[model samples]
Every structure is written in C-alpha cells, then in structure tokens.
Target chain A: MDSTVTTATNESVWGGGNQPLGASYGKLMMWFFLVSDALTFSGFLASYGFSRFKFIETWPIAELVFTHVPFFHGDYPLYYVAFMTFILIMSSVTMVLAVDAGHKMQQTRVIWYLFLTIIGGAIFVGSQAWEWSTFIRGDYGALETKGGRILQFVKADTGERAALADFAKNIPSEREDLQRDKGLWFQSEGYLTSRSVDEVVEGFVANPNILIRTETINDDNHKTVLTREESLKRIKDAAHVVEGANLIHNEYGSRLFADFFFFITGFHGFHVFSGVMINIIIFFNVILGTYERRGHYEMVEKIGLYWHFVDLVWVFVFTFFYLV
Target chain B: MAHAHKLEIFRGLLKFKTNVQKIWAVLVFLTIVTTIEVALGIIKPQALTHSHFLGMKVLNWIFITLTLVKAYYIAWDFMHLRDEKNSLRRAIVWTPIFLVLYLIFILLFEADYIYNVFKFGFVKWNF
Candidate 1:
C-alpha cells in the first residue's frame, strides 16, 4: 500500500497535521530548518577547508594560533579551546536532561536543567568573544614581504618566538591623525602602525639574535627560518610592518587564516547566542506552567532539538577549525 | 505526544535506572571522545600526523570520525530522532545529505584546481 495515498482526507503527507510521520508539526519544521542551517554551515566550513588546503604550506598551524588560555599568558596551546568545547557539549547534555524531564511532566527538574543549559551556553559565547579579541590583537608581529609573504621573528639561540615590542626600535616620529576636520578625511586610513618598515628593518639589522621565519612550512611542520644573512636580506625586502590581524594584514601567516577564523567562528558564536535566547523563552514558558496546561511538554523537546543541533554543529566546527 | 521511543542508548549496552541515567550515559561518551581528541591534538604523535590516509593525515581522520560519532549520539538519543517514524527521519536526514554532499564535492574540487593554478600558473606564489 502506498503511504502517500491518504484517500480519506484532502491533506496529503506533505500537508501539516496533528502528527506527520508520528512527529508533531513544529518538531518537523525545526528539523527542516536545522537541515538547511547545516548546509549553510557546511558551505562555510568547506570554503575554509579549501583555503587551508590551498595554502597548506603557509597556513598557520592551529596549535600555534590558539595557544592562549584565560588568566594564564604563556603558550598554553588548545587548553582554553578545549574547555570551551567541553562546556558546549556539557550544555547539550543538560538540554537533553531538560527534555527528558519534560517527557515525565516534571516541571521543577525541567527548570533546573534548562537553567544549567543557559549558563553553559552563556559561558561558551563569552569565551569565544574573548578568543576573537586575543586573535585580533595578535602576539608577536611580522613583516610582510614585497611578494606578500609574512616573515616572523624568532630567537636565534632558542628558536622561540620574539615579540615585535621586544626588538622593534621606537624611532621618534610625529604623524598627524586625520580627522573629519582634516582635508580628505574620508580617505584617511586608521591609526598608523607603531613602527614603519624602515624602523623595523633598522631594528632587525641592530639585533643579531632575531631570525626571520618564512611562512613556508618545512618537512618538520614548522616555519622555515632563514640564516642570519638571509634574514637580513628578507627584512630589507619588507614592504609593510604588520602588527596584528585586520581584514588587510595578518602577522600570524596567511591573511585568509584570519578571515576564515572570524567568519566561521563568528557564525557558530551567533548560533550559540540564539540558542541561549530560545532556551530562555522556553524556560519561562516551563515556569509559567504553559506546557502543564497543554498536557504535554513538547515545546521543550522541540527547542531541545535546536539546542542539540547547535552542539552538533560545534562538534564539526571544533574539529575542522581547531583540531584538523 | 503519541511518539516516544524506548529510552535507551547504545542498544541498551548498559541498562539505566531511568531516562536521566541514559542522558548521563550519552554525556559521558561525548566527554570521553572530546578528551581523546584534545589529547591527540596536544600530543600530535608524529607517526599519525606525517602519514596521509585518503588525502588527509590519519590524526585528522580520527578527529573527523570522533566528531561524527558525537553528532550521531546527540541526534539519535538527545534529540530523540530514534523515536520518530522512519518516514520523518528520512525526510529530515536524507534531504540535506544529498544537497550538502553535492555542494561540498564541487566546491572542494574547484578549490583544488585553484590551488594548482596558484602553484604552477602565473599567480605569484606569495600572493
């Protein structure tokens, strides 16, 4: 028998009903939205993957990029990001518990679990914002070559990264900031870099211990460091002093790395934020006894699907952006 | 609601005292998998990282596989996709699988072509 033939009614399986395929109308719609949303995310991640693969040699390794932990400043590599992922996955667990409580019509348990889930989401969102700021501010700066490659600095003896401020000679030079009152202010670029390419080049010449590390990754999966003579020649070819990541320049390695970092992680952060807001509304409804009056806590279950979808997306995001 | 599947995970690998216990079980599995992923990322064993399988590092393959496992548990148990009728499940899951896979395949291959152009063609290597 063909299930599509519902002879007794005008509504087909495609039409909305009490329960299509034994699932509520709202729940099914949520699934459809999630599937579409998943595709959107997939598009973003795949593009990021393409960019990473294209510049596989020059692309910044995720370990060196995400090496900052909150409240601790030395190289902590993947610790804080691990904590953030743990929080998000734990929130998914709490959300499932709330849905389970809803199934049993336990109002009190639902409230508590929902509360925990909201807290978990809030923490993840906050942590992501902090991470974005850290990345944008950057750490050790690099000089951009005429060919547009980034040349980083490292201690010759230790091969440890050296900060721009540690070696960049501050030459006293006055530059006027363009303002609305200034002529052609609209054409004005923002704040100038702390030091010019000439200044950094002079500084590099003065310091013999600092070596220039090229964006090219070697067989050992580390950036290629030039010899002292090559380092001098490389810095002389410097066209711009890039301090941190903006849309235009990135000191870490490839500028595309910064772009993908902002777009993909920002999209995920937005999802987590919206999921928290939806959970709050459902939390209020649970508290108001709305589901109890309806004799079913299906609303909670529906939102639980969205919440879990957010978590599932994060799993992929974490793997693609951070781990791989 | 008329739809409620038997509350169990892992094909009843270990019977739980209640649905709450089942929720905890899924949570534990996800945490353990994430821990392993993080540990691997940190240690990054040279053998796994250097070798390529299916055009990716074996370490990366492991991460992707673990992520999918976590996604499966979250979808099936937490979201109660298992409880839904087969038709609904297919409608929700199958629809995107086809479209997303198609888009990813085309775009990723195009990216590889572009990479080749940059590597061998007139586009300067640094730009």
Candidate 2:
C-alpha cells in the first residue's frame, strides 16, 4: 500500500490506485454505457420475439415481405439486407483501422479511414431510408378483413403472388370525395383507396384464376390458400383495402410485425445517424491535429467503440428480424 | 498508446503479423458467415425447416448460432474487448448476456402461453 499522502489522510482512496480495471475512466464509462444500450436493444428484440411467438402461425415471412431491391424487379430475398450487413461490417473494419493508425500517431491514415467509415455509415443510413419508404409503400396490395387479418392474392395456375391491380376492374361508384370544403367540414374522411372494397369483390368474382391466400400458416409452413368457393366466401368479409404498412395496418401480414420492424430498425437507424455525426466531429478533430497535440488519439478509440457497438447490434437485428 | 494486439483468431489456429492483416482476416470470416446465413435463409432447406429442436425450427437454431459467432468476433476483435482486462470485459459483456437470456426466456414462454389460450380456449383472435 502506497502511504505517500502528505495530508491528514494516510490511506489511498482506491484500494490499489485509480484504474483498477486497467482502463481509463472515459473508456470504462463508455463500455458501461454500451452495456446499458445493449440491454435496451435486447428489450426491444425480446418484445419482438414475444409478438412473433404470440402470432407464430400468422406472422409474415420475412423473405416474402422484404424481397424488393432498389432498382430490380425480380424476387431477391435477403439480398439488399445482406448488402447492408456487409456495409456495416466493412465500416466497422475501417473504424478499427482508424483506431490502429491513431495508436501509431498516423494522422493521415486515421483521417482517411475515418472518412471511409463516415461514407459507409451514410450509405447504410440512406439504404435504411429507402427500405422504410418501400415498406411504407408496399408492392402488392391486400385486403384487410374485419378482424384485422390480411388476405393476399395468388394466381391459381402458377401459385405465384398476384397483385390487386392485375385483376381489379374499375367500377364507377356514387361515393363522393370527402374534402373539407365539399361536405362535413369538421369530419374529413381518410385517404380513399383507388379501388373500393366493392370493386375488389366484384373483380374477384370475375377472375376465376385468382385465389385468396389467408394469413394462416399450414403444417407445410405456407400460407393457407382458399379454394374457389372459399375465396368467394372470404372476400365478403373484407372491410378495408390495405395498400402498405403503417402503425395501424400492414398489407404484408400481422400489424405487430410491421410495428416491431419499424421501431427496432428505426431506433437502430437513429443510432447510426448519431454515430455518423460523432465520427464526422472526430474526423474534423483529427484534421485539426487535436490528437497530435494531445499526444494520443484516445478520442478516436472511444468513438470506434461506439461504431463497433452499432455493428454488433445490427448483427443481432439481421438475425432475429430477417433471418429467423 | 501502441498497445500490442493479440493477433491470433479461431483459438490461435490462424495468426497475423500485423493488426491490419488481422482486421482483414476477421472481415473475411464475418463475410463468409453472413453469406452462409443469407444463403441458408433464401434456400431454407426442407429437411432443416421440418425438424424441430427445443420447440423451435432447426434452421433458426443454426442462424442464431452463426449470429452469435459473428457477434463474438466483432466484440472481441473489433471492439478490442479481447485486449481489455478481465474485469472490464466481464463488466461490459456478462451483464447483458445474463439479463437478455433471462428476459427472452420469460417473454417467449409467456407468449407461447398466450398463443395457446387463443388457439384452444374460447377466446378468439381479434387481430
């Protein structure tokens, strides 16, 4: 015990000294903060798991839901998401490289690596925004039953997904557009769907090749497709036409699935946004030679920890949300 | 602070001379794992999907395992947790691990119970 205190106190405040964990206070605090952040994410994922389990038979299959790429029109399941995963992982690599260069006081190398990391983060955030827009504007429209169930369409001959536009016939109706100035000034109606429920039902009766695919999953793990008569019977129960996903309704499948998808991914995207902002600030600091003057690049290392933590959370998110 | 990097991965089976080389190696490893995950997810082999273990699909088990492997490499190597002292590593890693497992177990079990209620009982599925 070092009893070298010259004041009235004879013993060291810390048992041995400061940094018993062999880490700086700032680094240790950062680690603790990450731990707490990890738990917050875990709570979200666990709730997601709960909802999935509760609706295990009716939960939407991720491959069918997220098959669209930015420009492509074909079915490419998990492709863009995989691309996003690779981008995040690559950015993590660049961040660690920057930290390594910082260790050696290579200011230029650190700056360049940080620049790459920033670009990677920007690309990821942009991709996420595109994904959210696509999810909001769903591809194939579906019918929402009175019980809040989704009924999609499939071609009877090909067993492939069929869009509502492929079969619905335009039927003129007497329904008036409810605008504020037109009628019911204080009671404006919701956005009217292009095709009404009556038109969809009328189209279904005309198209013999279309079948209704209900939300129920059979023993084969495929959605339960109703026969011709059953499809005719089920169409009468539909109350609304769901075009895309939102907090209330999802054309894909269960409303909970879309809710969790938006909340978890949105929260993660926010994290990436903040991480990019932090990285940019650090990039400017490096350019200004702040660390060089300080004789260490610990600031870069601290931010690197945060960047890697984001990647780590994405790894789990990719697994549970997309893969599992 | 020029700390010496512990450059070996995969239980010391592979070693790198420089930190940069090790970073690339880990990247390749993560990429391969992710590729396998994506491929399996897309194909969804019938045999694996049909089989159930621990009341969950075997395919999901594989995905979760691979995800854990990726998480391990990212945390231990990229975050430099491996180089951190034991106390700090445990403080950051163990707490979440224990709590998350417990939370998942409880929530999943409760969810399964609710699912059964909706399935067998008179209570109907409203949404």
Candidate 3:
C-alpha cells in the first residue's frame, strides 16, 4: 500500500501543470509583487538622477545640507543619519533571528525577536520624522526675488543666521487679516500673508544694516560662506538667493536633490511602517502557539523576506543618500 | 549507523547550536566596521582626498569596499546563502551585481557629461 501511494504521488509530482516559476504559489506571488515594487522605486530614483544631472552646477552638497540638528547645532554632519542607518540594520538582524527561531519551532524566541524588530522600526520612523522637520524648518531663511532668485542674509559679526525681520526696514505695521476677503469669495482656510517680493526688496534697500547677496557670489573657491563685506562687493552678481529648500527652488540647498531625497526616503519609511504592522500580527500568532500546532513556522520565513527587502533598500539608500 | 554519521557531518558543518553566538559576532563586527567607516569619512584626510582610484575618489572606493564586505556577511551568514547550492547562490547574487553596476555607470557618466555642459554651455545655470 505504501509503495502504491508513493508511485501515485511521484506521477503527480512529475505531471506538467501550469505551475508558476518552479516555485510555490505563494513565493511566486511574492516575487511578482517585489518586481513591480522594485520598478516603481527605480523610476523614482532614476528621475532623481535625471534632475540631479540637469542641475549639476549648483547642486547642494549632501553632507553640508543635512548637517544640522536641533539644540545641538553647528556642523553636525551625517552623524544622526548614520545612527539611523545602524538602527535599521540592527532591526534587520533581529528579523533574521526571528525567522531562525521560527524554523526551530521556538515560539517564545520568535516573539521576543519580533518585538525587538518592531521597536527598531519605530525608532527609525521617528528619526525620519525628525529629519523631515529639520529640513522643512530651515536654519537660515532667504527672500525670493522677482526673477526667481533667492537672496539670503547673515549676521555681520558672528555670521550667524539673520531673520527676515532683521532685513525689513519697515516691518509691516498693518496686520492684514489673511482670512479677510475682498470679494464675495471666502478666504482659504490655510492662507497666510507672506511677505511680498516688492516688500522684501524695499525692506532690503531701506535697511542699511541688512546686506543682500546671491548664493553663487561666494569667494573664488566657493568652500566658505561669503562675508558681509564680500557680499556687498558681489551684490551685482546675478545669483538668486532663496530661503529654504522647496519643491520649486531650494536656496538653502540643492532644490532638485532635496526633492528626490524626500520622495525616495519617504517611500521607504512607508514600507517600514507596513513591515512593522505585519510583524506585530506575526508576533501575536507566535505567542498563541498557532505555528506550534500547525507543525511549522513558514509564516515567519515569508515575513522575513519582506523585512530583508526593506534592509536591502536601506543599504542602497545609505550609499546614495548619505555616503555618496 | 551510517545515517548517524551523515547527521553528525551535517551538524558539524552547520554549527546550528552556536548560530546565535555567530550572529552576535557578525553584528559586533559590522558595528565596528561601520564606526570606523564613519570616522574615516568625517576625518577625510587631505592625502586620501587627493588620491584617486579607478576614476573615483579614494574615499568613495573605501566606502564601496566596506559596503561589499557588509553585504557579503549579510547574505552569506544571516541569509544562509553559504549553505545553499552554488547555482541558487549565484542566481540571487549576480542579478543585483549587474543591475547596480549598470546603474552606477550610466548615472555617473551622465552626471559628468552634465557637469561638462554646465562648465562650457552658452546658457549659464546660475543666470
């Protein structure tokens, strides 16, 4: 009877069915999804490379632009980002250990490892939020001129950041209610009255203390920020001084590069968030002995694939975004 | 008895019981290497900056080399690629190798071309 059963199974195993890619159905689907996701990421990164190429001359240096931190300011270059990378890498390690525990049928071990992985992921996401906030709230603000150029200001003595109000000769005394409407149309909910271009220029001309200069009018080597005296000499230089990094133009740093950096890293952060959720579900299952009763922990292996993919993407991200 | 010998051989090769210890060792090594890389990157000595290798900066080469080493350990030990069949291993590894190389080559070359255009183009980017 056993021999007959073995023969029957052998015939079915050799039979030509429309099986996918010589892999199990689940693994095949996972591969297909990964391929599409990879293409999407590639498209974003390629567009970034193209934009970087287009603005090759005045692109922001990655190290200098992302160097600042809150409270502990002054040239803290790449340290925080490196720490974030380590957190993600360590999470990947925990994920692998979880999978190994699952393979050994050690349910408690799986739970502990998964728990650690989730914590690591949460920390990474938090770090990313801090990074984004630092970027949006720029250290130095600049004024946008009519010709789409950015004009930035600095202190005369210490060369620290000078506020936009410091450059204003006549600070607008009449507080215009942004919500007040001239016509029948109601004002926009989020509308705020920003200082106008003419107002900025008038303020600059009026205030003898505030100096206006373009970003490109640096000293010969372009390594150091221009001094107030040097800035006065190069005022006629046709460089746009812009305040902060934005989608349209980044005067505080490289505009195109910043756009790509946010988009790519933001997508990866979304992936980490999803991975954490999946790991949570798996963690609960491990605690309940669901896999123990089922005789194997293949679920852990599947999720491990996803966790590793996140780590792999981060490896590339660290290289391009930070190291390069 | 013969099957028991085969089992012992497998156990010896895998070192399954000590896998956890090995994982910790790899993690510690990776941390040390990363710290060293960051230190070197921050210091960025003048001599290293002046040197070039294979049309790239020496510092960049060091980064690439260290990254490859990290990748090797991650793939081989953590992912158990070392225990897998050579064909399966190559299939997984070679694809990324070729793709990444192609991407770096095209992007860097185009970047240099664009740099040239900016340096000599009639249209000034700053203007």
- Against the reference, the lDDT scores of all candidates come to 0.85, 0.92, 0.66
Summarize candidate 2's per-residue lDDT along A231-299 as a digit string, tens digits: 999898899998989999999999999999999999999999999999999999999999999999999
Model 2, native contacts kept? 0.81
Which model is ahead, 2 or 3, in terms of lDDT? 2
lDDT of 3 by residue, A81-161 (tens): 889889988998898788778767888888999999999999998998888878866666676544454557666566555
Error of 1 at B101 (Å): 2.4
**Best prediction by DockQ:** 1
Give DockQ for candidates 1 onward, in order.
0.66, 0.62, 0.23
Give me the TM-scores of chain B across the candidates.
0.90, 0.96, 0.80
Of the true interface contacts, what fraction does each candidate have?
0.77, 0.81, 0.14
Work out the iRMS of candidate 2: 3.8
Between candidates 1 and 3, which one is better according to DockQ? 1
Sorting all predicted structures by TM-score, with the top scorer first, yields: 2, 1, 3
lDDT of 3 at A240: 44
lDDT of 1 by residue, A1-324 (tens): 214333345556565454536666787788889998998998899888878878777888888888899888698888898899899889988998888888888999999999999999999999999999998888888889888789999999999998877788878877776667777746765757777887788888999999999988898877899999999876777898888797778888898888888898999899999999999999999999999999999999888889989988988988988898
Taking all chains together, the TM-score of candidate 1 against the true structure is 0.94
lDDT of 1 at B93: 82
